[model samples]
Target: MNASTTQAYEPESHADQNSKNIIESIIHGLDTFRKFSRLYAFMGHVAGSFFSSLLAVDNLSQLNPTFFNGYLQYIVPHFFMHLYVVGLNQLADLEIDKINKPYLPLASGEFSLTNGIIIVASFLFLSFGAAWMIGSIPSFWGLLASFVLMTAYSVNLPFLRWKKSTILTVMSHVIGMTMSFNIAAFMHMKTFVLKNATSYPRSLFLVTVVMPIFYAVVATAKDLPDIEGDKAAGIKTLAVRLGSKKVFWFCVSLLQIAYGAAILIGASSPILWSKLFTVSAHALMALILWNRANSTDLSSNISLQSFYMFIFKVRVAIK
Candidate 1:
């Protein structure tokens, strides 16, 4: 069964409900750990970004055997990047999360701070080790960059704070994604940038541009549901800083703008018919967001769930 479904069965009372609560809480804590880390988003984004760049390369050149072969080698670095981001994001957010996301594992008392330290240690070991195994110092540096930025945004780095500023909040996403895209491009330079411009198909550029824009929007969309807690905690996210009305308009406007840009870019390019699927997915999401954003307050769980679902849908579409 699903984690949430399993989580729902925890008893409210029992002879030893406190002990049982602790166990159930641990389960829920793990679930929260999985959910908020944006692990799925990170994986999907890396996969989409990498493959779209590859497809761009394929479309630009005659299909060569070497280009087609050994593509799986990329997955090692991709996994390393995703693992680092997911684990680090969760660990970094632990403090702000207590205020803005009280339902999270640590905030909800599902896991102790001591347990959290152990988890973070394990996550770092696996992440850095994977990066090192990929045989690129740059890849390991990228892993380090992920940890540093996550920490800067969520915990320390008062000098470069994004947790309490709307502009910085959105800018952090753009910067992070830009770094990911550039690092991925650097790692797979042969496929991402070797084609001559005169011979390069426009389809590749379309994918590169559209994918990152989609990622930025998905990241910002997450802020909508956190406004209440953010305000209470003095975390001036886009939602809290702009207030609900402006944030609503901002998200919708971004969705429409990105959708329009994607459609136009795709139509003008030579991307395959299958690639049009991402556009269709975004159109459906726009409709879903419009309907849900109108009917639900930002603080409602349904609103938060819808935001999460949209991120998942975007990931699937791009992949």
Candidate 2:
């Protein structure tokens, strides 16, 4: 009787264990989805599309259904490119991420390194393939430039890990952001069959100059919260080299200069309404950034991170 009772209990316990294992696997799958691709960052690409759309249309009246369709077509490839770049970075920085961003899928063990590799590979194939399918030389070149920069930043080769050096890091970001903007802008221009390779517009030139400076600040500030992890990993980021306080002030000054320049441009715009709106918006953004920077508690990583996102918001406003 005792042996029979034990045998009956063992089967039930095994079944229960199998169910628990399945549930755990499901939970981890969900976490991987949440943390791996980082869907929130997709908004940057969407904003790029919006700016491109604005530049593509001659006026509000020209923004019809076709314009919207073109935006979708252009944005899809951009989105995959972002995923590929970001995913590769995440994969390459798995150790650093374990220190600086433990909640990330690969770092947290919610997703295996193999899983990350597969996802990034898929994104890369889709991004380049989609760009080719679009059959726009400008768009393809823009994506190619972005891909090269992103690869340089992530690949662990001599002088390739641009994230380790301050100057290289800044240069990489500047070039990357410029390429990202151009990718969408050029795609929009292509959709309308506009004259490609013509003289650059004043607005385009301004954006090209401004975005790099803005991205420089963001790139430096991003390292602030990860200084400890970066130092531990022997990655000499700007924050690690200059100290967080100096880097913070440096980012602030850069932002101030950017906003000042925007305000000046807005003031000089020939259109009266454009002048007022741009000037007012930039002024407000400057004040907000200054206030946030002052109130930011450097010791609180969350606070610093939030302020960084706020900077991104200000950037979008300028656009």
Candidate 3:
């Protein structure tokens, strides 16, 4: 071919190659999103925000058009915050996850360490920026608490890895989740009534107290599945300190306590139908959890993971 002809073909080839690269990048991004379980995080924030809003208003009527707008405002920032936290945890635990959770994007080589870092940093920026735009006290506190807790849980800088300590791990999850709940509640109040935001209700306080026990169960049960990785990493998780069997029973006991408390609280309700339904529900849940606990295979990590998800189901029921 002549020089002019060759040059013309070269430009076309370059354009095709660039287009292919762009398509590949988009596909890889989607795969990374799937591996990171972003959908579950999104749904979780939705449910948490909804429940918190319910607690704040204490009536179904308050869930009007404005409630949804406020919800979107709250969830947008919280969603990015959740992403930031999860990404940071994955980045910090890449090696450990390679052993325990090889399917993760970072551990599986679907996303490079640099890619993960960029994703995390971007999410962190977006989380804070969205929170600032919301401009509510609850939004500010939620963002701040999430930053502090996630930093303590994941960031290894200055060795603040709270995951290495069982108590610290549980406390971090409890406090972080509580802050998340209250953030939602505050967002609802700010949206509806800026001047006189509702004070923290007694019911929410009780929820904060009881829910942490379940959070502790989830925290420890999660470790039961990753015992090998945790042990190798010199992480003193509760499941590492106590045998998996013991940890399993410990979680079961916590569930029982939580359900028992729910039953007692339900029994004292003034409304007869509410009392019967709540008490019956808790009783049934406790029995079902006990039965499942009995049949669960403590030796299998998958089974333990399933049980952990079951705890989440029970938590939703309680809510």
Candidate 4:
């Protein structure tokens, strides 16, 4: 071939290589987004928030705000809580993620701490802004506490870990449950007060707070799958402290007792039967979740992931 012909071939070759590189880069970027598990994190906050909200406020229609404030309340707190949960998981599972979830954006070098920090800041700003819109100091501060817990969990503080302090895990779950419940309750209250300010029932206040604690116990079962990861990471989850079987049975008993309690509550109380039925449904769902929680067969590990996914699906379907 002549020199001119050779030159032409070289440019074509370079062009082909560049095209391939660009295509690969695009594919990898999309894959990294999936690994970040953003949707799953959002679903966690949504689930916790939805159930708690259901318990607190009976009517969903009363949340209308005059400005963007209404939409902000509905969206911002959950956004912050969800992102915070994702960041904390990535931070805590730093080692375990290296093994099991290396494809995660941070673990795989597809994303950076700077990127994570930016995302978290955006969430916090949106959350705080939403809380401000709600016009309730206590509830707004509840969201602020949610942000604080998220920060505590994401950063390695002096005394907080799976090994060093069960208080972290305990308080984290309790606070999360309250955040969700309170949002729901606050919305419901506005609805009730708007419709019949004079006749607003008082019992709802008690039920909203109590119900999330019970459901929170059921959500604790997810800690079981993380047992090995938790142990390796030197983290102390409820499963680690309670024993896998113990955690399973304890959740099961909690579900059963909650169900029975609802039946009894309905039989003797003047409160809404729907409230009892709602708790009953959650307890039944927990019982169903317990079946997978008790799986000792070891061969069904993949199935267990599916089971949890199903739980998530059902929770989302409820609201």
- lDDT (10s digit) by residue, model 2, range 1-319: 9999999899999999999999999997886776777665667556754785566555666567766766666677878888888889988899999998999878888778888899899988998898788766666666787799879988899868888778888888777777767544654564544433444455665676666778888778888888878998999987898888888989999998998888888788899998999789889988988988999998877887887777777777778
After superposition, candidate 1 runs with Cα above 4 Å error = 1-38, 56-92, 137-145, 181-201, 270-301
In the range 1-319, model 4's lDDT, one tens digit per residue, is 6998999899999999999999999998776766675686466555555444444444556444522243345556656656666766675566777765566777776667788767656766766776666564545656666656655655665744432355555567566555554544345334422333323244444444445545455357666666776677776777788776677566556545554555445445565666666566656665665565565443344544454455455444333
Per-residue lDDT of 1-319 in model 1, one digit per residue for the tens? 6987656665544537798889998987668767645566666655664664464453545446544432333445545456555555556666656766676666666767777667666667766776566454444555566566655666545586566665565566666664555444334434323433323445556555655566566666677766665666666666666666676666666666766676666555455674567567657766765775577565565666576566556545543
TM-score computed on alpha carbons, candidate 3: 0.87
**Model 3: residues with Cα > 4 Å off, grouped in runs:** 1-29, 183-195
Q: What lDDT does the true structure give each of the candidates?
A: 0.58, 0.78, 0.80, 0.57
How high is each candidate's TM-score?
A: 0.69, 0.87, 0.87, 0.68
Q: Considering TM-score, which of the candidate structures 3 and 4 is the better prediction for this target?
A: 3
Model 3 scores worst on lDDT over the 10 consecutive residues at 188-197
State the lDDT of candidate 3 residue by residue for 1-319, as single tens digits. 6998999899999999999999999998788797785465446556665776666665677678766777777778888888898899999999999999999999999889999999999999999898787776677687778789868998777769989888888888878877785555555455543334467765576577677777677767878899999988998888899899998998899989998988888788888998999899989999999999999998899998888777777777677
lDDT of 3: 0.80
Index of the highest-lDDT prediction = 3
Better of 2 and 4 by TM-score: 2
Worst 10 residues of 1 by lDDT: 191-200
* Position 164, candidate 2: lDDT: 77
What TM-score does candidate 1 reach?
Answer: 0.69
